[model samples]
Target: MNKARIAAAPSPAGLAFRLVFAAAAILLALLSLPQAGHAQGIVRGAQEGSYEGNRIAGPVGGAVGGVVGAGVGGAVGAVEGVLGIPHRHYRHRCHGYYDGYHRFHCYR
Candidate 1:
């Protein structure tokens, strides 16, 4: 059969079915994210806790503590990712970087 014949075979119902399935799949993926990130929430909660602690721990200590804590958390997560250590403590998003001529998001 020619391509046109194959293309014309399905009716509107088929098209609607495909669209609904696609949408449901997308919704499922989107809904799964927060549940997936519940582990990351622990790290985020810790970050907030330290931030609050810093306020009480004194200005100098707080600033130092917050920076060190966040940095260590991110770095440790990155290393664990490389080493295949299963964790969900932090979520990392890669924003595109720019050189004079280029921009890229490295996540994908």
Candidate 2:
């Protein structure tokens, strides 16, 4: 029974493989750090801008919009990071209306 158990146990090569696989997995996880806020913001902004521009105009407009959007997004992201403000989510609702002077008002 003991000999049978020993034969059934994993071989040294199998153990080495498992260790190498685990190490590789750990290394990959470590390498894939979360993107910075500004980077994410910029990417999102550029994509949105490009889409809108393409819908409204042509390729030239899309390019221009992408550049402008990226700049704005980067600035906003930087400010949010500095202020320690979390990213906004659509789940939150705000009640608002336009006032008499064409100014918008919001209440949460």
Candidate 3:
């Protein structure tokens, strides 16, 4: 009777294949992250988050907005979700621009 070995070492080719697959998987995961994160930004922005990481207020007042709109807004707010709703002016009357500090500045 012959029995298969469950703890046998993998062949060089098999090991290489597994390593390549793992690397590819990791790379794809990393690459997809930014795209996914950008989508989230558009959402938080549409929801009246800061405009490009700026802490400016939205249609609602700053002191009144609280934790709801805590992300960047404006052009970043133009991104539509999977539902494809028009969010161009989701930030309301807010405008966005780069500040002298090389950071995004958004406000009414």
Best by lDDT: 2
Please provide, for model 3 over 1-108, each residue's C-alpha lDDT reduced to its tens digit, 9 standing for 90 to 100. Answer: 999778977689998999999999999989754445345654564444333223554434433443344333423433444345654543424578777897767765
lDDT of 2 at 84: 72
Write down the RMSD of all candidates, one decimal each. Answer: 17.2, 11.7, 12.9
Clash totals in order: 0, 0, 7
Q: Compare candidates 1 and 2 on lDDT and give the better one.
A: 2
The candidate that wins on TM-score is 2
- Predicted candidate 2 versus true structure: per-residue lDDT over 1-108, tens digit per residue: 455443577689999999999999999998765456447878988998888887888898899889988898888887776677998675425678778997667885
What lDDT tens digits, residue by residue, belong to model 1 across residues 1-108?
656544557789999999999999999989754443334534764576578767878776666666667666666655555466776554337654556676554545
Model 1, stretches more than 4 Å misplaced?
Answer: 1-10, 35-58, 67-108
For model 2 the local lDDT of residue 108 reads 57
Candidate 1 minimal-lDDT segment of 10 residues: 33-42
Q: Candidate 3 — which pairs collide?
A: 49-71, 50-71, 50-72, 50-73, 51-72, 51-73, 52-72
Candidate 3 at residue 108, lDDT? 57
